[model samples]
Target chain A: MMPAALSEATPLLSVRDLTVRFRSGRETVTAIDRVSFDVPRGRVLGLVGESGSGKSVTALALMRLLSPDMAEIAGEVRFDGRDLVALPEGEMRRVRGRHLSMIFQEPMTSLNPIASIGNQICEPLRLHLGLGRKAARDRAAELLAMVAIPEPRRRLDQYPHELSGGMRQRVVIAMAIACEPRLIIADEPTTALDVTTQAQILDLLRDLQSRLGMAIVMITHDLGVVAEFADHVQVMYAGRGVERAAVRDVFGHPRHPYTGGLLRCIPDFDGDQDRLVGIDGTVPSLTNLPPGCAYAPRCERAQDDCRIVVPDLEAVAPAHRAACFHPLEFAREVSP
Target chain B: MLNYIARRLIYIPLSLLLVLCAAFVVLRATGNPIDIFLDPNHTPEQADVLTARLHLDQPILVQFVIYLRDVLRGDFGDSLQFGGPAMPAVLDRLGATLELLAAALGVALVLGIFGGIACAVWRDRTPDFLISTIAIAAQSMPSFWLGILLIQIFAVDLRWLPTSGRGDGWHLILPAATLAAFVLPNFVLITRTSMLEVMGEPFVVTGKAKGLSAAKLLFTHVFPNALNPILSFLGIQVGRLVAGSIVTETIFSWPGIGRLLIGSIFQRDVPIVLAGVVVVSLFIILANLIVDLLLSINDPRIRLG
Candidate 1:
């Protein structure tokens, strides 16, 4: 038997060399390139990137929700000592909802419009747990209350359209946690909400993660949310993770040029800078990517070598890595 | 919800009035039926009698008023071909038409929706292409031709069932199938497109992420959202089926309202023609109203609106 301490140290979910490519006509585009990370028990790992950085695709791939016909997925998704990528679909279904759940970006569209909020939440309970209707309904009511929805009983019969965006998202979260999943992959869960509601939802998620002891993969482009909630951070550029480290290390010493550029884009409250810094150039087309580092064209310090050799993730610190030929030194990092 | 229905109901009377006015003007302008009723060598007295009987000698405006009054009072006048009140003659044959419509609709909807969902689920694959080709063929073929072909194969050649006329349940199958085949393509295409659209929606992604089985996700989540457009298309299809039965019923010699309508038209039976138009129009309006009500019930957003 494994030691208790060793078992405790093992991450709940570990992804290695995850790659996803989409095919359209004759061209194949890599949406997620060699993405790898870990979500330890009861910890929050924020996956941050701009649009088209494969952040959403990574989450979808982790859930095995992407269409097999359109996307060709490779790599290992090891969850609880099981290799998920190799699991048959029938087996995967059992893992989903029971062990893993995902909250989508748009709350308005995530919940089934025709279904009542309670029914949607009760679905996973009924499907995975095989609970009878009455038991499921009672549990659904409990979940509504757990998500902090007022008048949970009355709201049970209300459809998704009848609920506000914030309320709808809470219903989505309630549904995600209905079967008490061990891990929840929330893809931009607050992107559709207002600022106040966004903060509240994030706070709720953090609180729920602690209470339920469920690890979370929070996929978002908002670094602010990442800073406040994430225990570890993975910064994606193009289709690959350019930097992966503890949240403080990622913010305090951003080694990848892409990560440093992204940090500079964030506005400082008391800083006298006239304008927030912006990353130059757009993301290269996935179908026709450059041979080297995807960010080489956009990196201010791009050398001739940076344009030719694809950099593999190299350790900059213990458990901290970056996929860049010329990583920023500690002195050159934007002061945290 | 009741208020929304009431608001929609207001359009019914307005539409009926317009239909009636158009039918009256067109019928009057087509010919002086009194002249046709009399021979060229006939006496003036015969002409006078025909004119007075039809109330055509009155001013057009007065004639319209009388016609409207008679219609309101349920006197659709006499059917020149059927030897009775036009309304009763039409209603008598209505049972057969309704039966045929119900059978055809059942076949069309079941096949169409199931076929559409299958195509969407297996999209871009061989099954999708195969089913789509068959649907297109079914849609393009003329119902009357198809009916005859079915009769040739099933009734004439195989001698499995009766060729024409309606009595036993078995007699209804051929005509119903023909009608169903004619309308099935629209249902299949509409349902497929609607389902494909909903399949791409974020909620469907959410449904899948919830670990729902493929069948469950499609039927429970995607199907309901896709249903609104399909239901609206179904309303129109219902009306089309009613109209289409005219051809199918005629070919099958099914003794339906459509056959009676054709006989009345041949005899220049003004009352029967006008009554048929108004009744069919009413049916169309009712179908639309039902579709709207069902849509509102299924989709909460429409109810809220």
Candidate 2:
């Protein structure tokens, strides 16, 4: 594997020891527990996690979208030489659309329904880039064309309801890329779309990333998507990342039992198994997390001590790390 | 869209016919109009002549047909007290009612919508709580009582405004305020509720993520998106306000159609009362029709024929 070290310039986005907690009533619930990762310039980082695993929360935290009064955030989110966690809202506003952007999960609802598609696309450009009305409008049409939306000019005047699901997702992508932000965070961008549409959107994202040379934080539970697009993969469990590695290393040598369990759940094309494998237990609740490793209760290779002691994310290989008391052996690996 | 509008339009005449028929039957059931005007000196022959002259001696069905035909011909008969065409009398008083409606609606909309927006933006905060409480209290308060309360405070006690009657803008204050109080709560509640719901929508999140200021996000994305439902709601409320002006006008002695209608009822002036009812009904229906058209115009998704 390549060294994958930080080059001379700063990483596009670097998050370290990010913790998020909510004070509801008298209890303090941890939403994101010491989560950390980095996205190098122009590379894709796939954050793989199931529901309640802090994937979306992390994205919201990065964008400072969560209410500060409600959610207590403690972390260092350094991007382009500034600590986003410490930035004031006014300065944060400038960084948001101009330097960073996000695409949401549901295309059906992720647009202002009454707003014309063209106007919505032109909004960020006008606000961030200071483009004139005619110029922004023209640029919006170009973006639509870039996303392969047919009759881009006409589609601009149409409302979101007039467009198909795939078309709406494309429009969402067009909005995210409007300002040419250095980084884009897309959370489950294709979960609401059909399989065919999902593939098209993923392809569009890949094409845009290469052409624009922008980093992407692709958050999804679908490993297949990560394998196809991401350079690095981070597997999160119970509000914290349990594994971090290059996409190939994580897939080829899944050292953590939870990561191995996730990989085993994926159906193989040539395997003779009639039923697919699934992990035994559900993700732990935020307010009632176990004292030990969050995935220990569900780990097949769990030891007695694993139930009492939390595991640190220690290095298992070059550019590969996993949090597990007893790491998985390589003999059970399924080649990607 | 055209088909939808045409279909809605076709229901109007049918509804008017029903209302006309109902009003005719109900008015006759109330007893003889001539008996109320008779003095002890009047002989039975005089009563008969009066009854025949007014076509009251005819069969009920015949009278109804004549009434319908006359109404179609723009004749609403003569007023018993005023002794002129009842239609013209009612039409003359309509201006006062319209003025009250305009002022009331203007206050209700401005206060209600802005207050609702404030509540939604600061939901669960102190301002939200205060505004919501006021809205609830206003909604529950009857217009008659509210009018008296306004008169008691501003007219009787403070002497800052007139107790009753409409001449200048100052005289309109109490009545319009009472009516506006009745309407304001609904606007506040609906706007707050709808805006809160829309604020939770994914697009709102997208707007925030796009670095839009709170004000821009609200007016541009949240408020506009939340407006269609409120517009349709406002249409219904406006139509209701026109009809509801009866009580407000009577309490304030504002010389509107409502006050005139009540006086005609006490006088057993059937033609005048019926004319007033029909005119007011027509106004309400027309207002609602305009509202429907406006709703369609505001929302492109709502196509009109």
Candidate 3:
């Protein structure tokens, strides 16, 4: 489980002050608040959040996949030391499949319903790699075989409707790794899948990540998924990062009350059932976010100033930071 | 499949029986058949003698049974006006209408589908705007008016094409274009709408995630998935085109069944008129069945008991 092909130092993607906005009639809604993060080579950065927290928006913003009239974006996104924000559409297309790739959460609706699994896998190679037709087809078969699809050759001629939801997602993963990109932004990749399939997909992703030495941004709402996969973690609320730290530091000594509430919310496998706790209030509407720290309205430890003053990301310990007016008490040991 | 065929076949007889009954009842029930057939100057006694000679003296039940029996045997008597066997004339002209409808539907399918896919892929682009505008404009105009306008422009003034007739000569261009223009918009619009919906699915992004380019995505993905709902639209249009060909055929002076039916209606030749309706209805039903079969194959959801 040591870093295999990756060097110890090298950040593959840098997102800086990326802002995305939507306009409805006369009202303007900023979907993604100015956000920044770094994904190191061969590292898994788990982006944890509740729904409508702009976790998916951050991933979509990287690929420039938002609709033309819907999204207004401005900010710096640099991948492999190259600025992606200002690149022309033509050049960005070349970069999308070759140097960068992404997988969506829904396995069912993600594959083209009419195209054969093989054709879907071969698309990037044919477009960007410029391999000859026979070689591209041969590589497509190889990809299916690598993904462990049974009878890879016959699958080449079979359409997407013939495959189950799990197989279709496997096809999607095969296509993602076809070009062996430097960065793979898998947005809630296992959320739509069954429990057993989710584990297999996670394992496949991790195996491929280490072998390819690719940086992965695993965005999810599930804290349990982060525990199993993420080496580093960033928790977001109201489109802003509230806490970020190593996985050990994050769950072991919970600094932010939001992070503490989130960790307590999860049902422990080996614990007294009565001890499990959940935050009471629902997430506030992004269009009408609460004043001061967005979590203050829901935080039981909120002070008078916490309702008026915003908290910036400040270090609680080495390589650990939280945005909170009052930090939580860290137990001597994690609850396991 | 055989049960379906058998069920449909049963409807054919049941349909013809009703038509035969209507023809018999309406023809005689409205007025004295012999009186209408004979001179008005004749006396009542003369009219009675003439009716008796013509077998109008027979009991109504006896007449109906004999009539139904004759019709079942395909001895549809001569049209009072045309003085020819009804079945042969109906069958001959049904062929002509079928040919026109097939050609028109063929043209509509090719142009509508490809144009729709193009418009959806380039939505909000100039070409998409242009295709949609043309389809809407064509769809808004009456087919009869469109036919007249096309005749005036291409056939009468420009003289580059013939006015009418389905022939080896340059006669098909205008009428075929007339039918196609009417059918094309529904096809294009349905396709465009469905294609837009399919394009919006998260899977298209998945396809993009797989690194598919514009051309491959449209043909392989967008076009096929969008094709499902449009099958019903296409079937409905085929039936409309068959019924609609009456106006087009009349305007163009084409000797198809529509023109024949109009002539029969003028002559009070009810048998041939009924035959025309029957033929067109059969064609509509058949086209729909074929379309349903194709749809089941495409979507894999629809199946028969």
The two-chain DockQ for each candidate, comma-separated, is 0.75, 0.70, 0.43
What does candidate 1's lDDT look like per residue over B51-159, in tens digits? 8987988998999998888887878887777668889878888799889988999999999999998888888899899999999988889888899999999999999
Q: List the candidates ranked by lDDT, beginning with the highest.
A: 1, 2, 3
Estimate TM-scores for all models: 0.94, 0.95, 0.82
lDDT of each: 0.89, 0.88, 0.80
What lDDT would candidate 3 get against the real structure? 0.80
Query: Model 2: residues >4 Å from true position, as ranges?
Result: A1-8, A330-332, B1-8, B33-62
Model 1 regions lying over 4 Å from their true place: A1-6, B36-57
The digit string of per-residue lDDT tens for model 3 on B1-305 reads 55555655676666666766777777677567665555668888888887775567789988888777766676665666666877678888876777777778889999999888888878889989999999999999999999999999998899999887767647766887888988899888888899999989888887665556667777777777898888988878886887788888898887899888888877767557656666666677677777776776665434343
Candidate 2, residue A248: the lDDT equals 86
User: lDDT tens digits, residues A222-268, model 2?
Assistant: 99999999999999999988999999888988988888888888998
1 or 3, which is superior by TM-score? Answer: 1
The lDDT, on a scale of 0 to 1, for candidate 1 is 0.89
